[model samples]
Target: MTVDKESDKGPYICNGTQSSDPEYTQSSDEVTLTVAEKPEPELTSDLKGAALTGNSVTLYCTLKLQSAGWKFYWSKDTQSRETETETNHYFIRSVSVSDEGQYRCRAGRGNPVYYTHYSDALWVTVSGESPPVSLIINPSRSQHFTADSLSLSCEEQRDSTGWTVKRYTL
Candidate 1:
């Protein structure tokens, strides 16, 4: 019997009776069946934002409760790309603009092949140019007095909304 809903989970018992001169009955131990909804695998990438062209990136597909005998499947832009793959990590040796797309993954295991829901899409963008960032100091000069006031700013060739400034001093 195939169970597909939570409401079907409960305890079950089998009873048997025999008819003769004296009626006899026997009862077996109760057996409980538990059912749970299939979980969706989580998809993640090493690159936090746009990936530079010719750079390598790795995508990982994982489940909360990991088990053995799972085969992973990867898709790009809703198109089936990999099927029945043994590894959970998808490695891209080199990425290009043509590789940019919405990627997703799913896992399947066990006999009769039970499959989990597809993971959330991870959008990958490939940039041809490398991100350029420079630091600008106001009152441009080689020497600065002890109390001299100076302004430090960060400039980027592209968008600087998410850029961070860091400095190391002895």
Candidate 2:
């Protein structure tokens, strides 16, 4: 039997009677049937189109009701990516060629483990080429005095932002 809607849930009891003795009748105990709604997770990407190498991207998985005790799962190319996490969002700090694949996500809750339907696949493509970058140092010189004032900046040919300068000192 199929339950079409939530209103179909209710208590049901069966009654039986003996054909030989029309007056004889028996009633079964009442039983209530419960219907739990299945969750369908929604998957979305922060950036559209193909992502460039060295860029960052984030994927979001969410439910309509937003209940508690939900843990999100992420996968790429049908293979599990990260361990279960409480947060609904998955972040990739620096995208690489290996990161390109069909991504999907799902959510689960409860002890017995009730899982929502996997969200639609989100295709992620990574460009093998990185934007051209040039480093410029003020007072252009190969060597500088310890007390000399110096400045460094990174310039990218593309309009992309979020670049930072890092240095290692001994």
- Please give, for residues 59-151, the per-residue lDDT of candidate 1 as tens digits: 999988777889999999998556457899998878989889999999998889888999999998998644456667899998899999998
lDDT of 1: 0.84
> Candidate 1 regions off by >4 Å?
13-31, 129-170
Q: For residue 4, give model 1's deviation from the true position in Å.
A: 3.2
Q: Model 1 reaches what TM-score against the true structure?
A: 0.63
Among all windows of 10 consecutive residues in model 2, the one with the lowest summed lDDT is: 161-170
lDDT (Cα, tens digit) per residue for candidate 2, span 86-124: 899999989999989988899988889878888899998
Worst 10 residues of 1 by lDDT: 161-170
lDDT of each: 0.84, 0.84
